[model samples]
Every structure is written in C-alpha cells, then in structure tokens.
Target: MKNKIKLCILLLFSLSISAQKSNKPSTFERYLQTKELVNVQLIDSSIRADLKYATTDNFAKTILYDTLFNIYAHPVAAEKLAKAQKYLKELNPELSLLVYDAVRPLSVQKKMYKVVQNTKYAAYVANPSRTGLHNYGMAIDLTICDNKGQPLDMGTSFDFFGRAAGINKEAELVAEGILTKQQVKNRNLLRKVMTRAGFLTIRGEWWHFNAVSLSEAKRLYKIIE
Candidate 1:
C-alpha cells in the first residue's frame, strides 16, 4: 500500500513537470508532427511568432485558432525561415523575423474563405476548395521586428486588403503620398531578406510569401486537413 502511494506521488510529480514543459496541448503538437511540419522555434528559437490568426485581431475578426499558438511549417519553409532570420541578424543583429501566420489547416482555410468571400478581400483569401500554399506548410506570413519583438512599420498592418497593402505598386503608391518612402524602405528590407532566402512574394499581400511555387507545393506534399 505504501509503495502504491509513493508511485502515485511520483506520477503526480511527473504530470506537473509535463504540464509545465508541454505548454502546447498534445493535439496541437501531434497535428504538427503528423503533418511532418517543424516548429519554427526548434529551428531558430530567436524567430518570433505572433500568429495573428490565432487571435481575433486578424482581418477575419474571429478566433481562427483558439488552441494553436506556436508556429510550424514544412521542413523546406522552416529552413528558409531560419535563413531569413540569419540574414536579417547578419544585416542587423538587432532585427528579427516576426511571423504572423504559417501552416494553416484546411478547416481554418475554410473559415478564412467564409470571412472574405463576397467581399473585396475574396481575391486575397485562398479558396478552401483549392488549397493555398499555407495548407501545405509551404508558405509564410511574416515581417521584420526589432530585438524588442516589436514589428517595423511596413506601411499597413498584416492582412490589410487594399492598395496600401499591395507591394506591386509601391513606387506609385509612394509617389501618390499613400505610402511613405521610409515605409517602402522597410518593406524593401523585408523583401530583401525573404527573397534572398528564396521565398516568392505575391503582388497582393506584402506579408505573405511562398517557400516554393504552387506547382512544386502540389507535386511534393499533401495539404494539412
């Protein structure tokens, strides 16, 4: 009877330590590992992730991810993310890459679609029927931040849909007095590191990037459902 009580006490102690260590719920990390995705922090602990969609602060104005907080991505994307962080650190050790979103699941994609569909934001949000690069863990939405983890002014906020958020006409936008040259410079710095890291930028969202082309993503991996 004493041995059983001692064993029970030991089990409780182990559980307490486990609870402290596994900050993320089991299902969360399981999904990440099941998809064969890498936690960004595991690659580069200094790489920060805000996961805007995890909260209600995003464009959708809903809690898309109530449980998920940590950032995860395909190995290819994760490696490139680390490279971007390294490059940024090389350029200015004070700066870090701040991730907004990564490895969006199909369920979350559907929710994102519902919020944007029939609105002007529709074109920007990927339709669930046709999975986005993020679903394959092959894309990232991030920005540059200071050592304090505060993001630089990249003109508009993340998930901002409109001419202000578009990178295609930054020069014209700057000339129009819509976006400042300093803002353009900041955006350019972000582009420099990410492009150097081999991520492709889209004409629409400056924060969004693809680790590989859509063709490569579709051919190489399955979407996270």
Candidate 2:
C-alpha cells in the first residue's frame, strides 16, 4: 500500500516534469525511479551509452523515448553488464562497451512496432503483444568504442535491417565482400566480453545480447509497462 502511494507520487512528479522546461530532468528518469530498475552507470561507470531510441537517430526516424537519457535495467541484467564492462577493460583497456539500448517500457515498444509493423523490419522489432527482451529489461544492444568514443566499424551501422546485421553469416558475408574480415573481428571482440559475462547472442542481431532466455525472463521478471 505504501509502495503504491509512492508510485503515484512519482508518476505525478514525472508528469509535472514533462510539462516543464526541456533542460530539466525528464519524466522517464522519474518514472524509472518508480520501478525496481537500476541505472547501469551506478554498477559500472566505464560502460558508455548512446541510447539510439532516446534520439531521432533510430530506424523509426523519430524520438521513441521523449526524454529517456540514461540506460536502466533490472538488477540482474545490470550486474552482468558490469561484468561485461570489467572483461572489456581487461581485453582492451583503451576500449569500452558502448550501449545503444536497454530496458524499454512496453508502451515504447508498441510505438516502435507501429513504425515497422508494415515493413520487412517488422520481424526485427518484436511485436509488443508477445513482448520483447528489452521490455523485460533482459536484453541489450551495444558495440565497442575506443577511448575517444568512436565506435568500431562493425560493417553495418547499428540498427541496420539487412542480412549483413545477422550474426549467422559472418563468413559468408565476408566472402561475398558484404562484410570485411576486420569488421568481423570487431564484432567478435564485442561478443567475447558479452558472452563471457553470461549474455546469450541471438543469431539475427549481432549487436543484441540476452541476459537470459525469454522463458526464464517470463518466469523471473515482470515486463516494464
């Protein structure tokens, strides 16, 4: 009962913030506090973020998240992300894991699906009815970046909707000159740290890593609404 009251207060505060100045803290930041989510930086500061959905730079060509600036995740996922960051530092002290997206609300997922539902990219964006790993705060999309914060060339850019983005055909893509050997190496480096940290890589998206299986996620965590 007390928690419910606190949640209502936070929601009101978030709504108030949303109506205020653009430079002020956002509603999503306040809303995140209403949940059991953790800010990834609190677990590990070295992991950098370039949350695509927060900006208009995503495939949707729109700002999916109105004012979501920081990356947040379930505590379980956050710990593994921190472990990945530790492994990344050990592998290449000059490089760090740069996050592209993290825990997303189901409301945002619906908006994202609306943008791609009629296109070939629909499969890539999970239907909100079925829910997605990000909705469960168990999936991450990221890449490796240098000390200067320049992302390594992974052949296709982040959120590229094509065969080149698929992890299953690296050798074939390379042989066909669609992806270079160096690009594959850069991708492998990212996979190395994430896999070592217990994240599972899906075949269709090289940049995506799951903290656990969908079934396990359903059993353990509630989707963020």
TM-score of each: 0.87, 0.86
Residue lDDT tens for model 2, 145-205? 9999999999998998889999999999999999999999999999999999999999888
Candidate 2: lDDT over CA atoms? 0.88
lDDT of 2 at 166: 96
Error of 1 at 180 (Å): 0.8
Q: Which regions of candidate 2 fall more than 4 Å away from where they truly are?
A: 1-25, 117-120
The positional error of residue 35 in candidate 2, measured at the CA in angstroms, is: 1.9
Per-model clash counts, in order, read: 0, 0
Local distance difference test, candidate 1: 0.88
**In the order shown, what is each candidate's alpha-carbon RMSD?**
6.2, 7.8
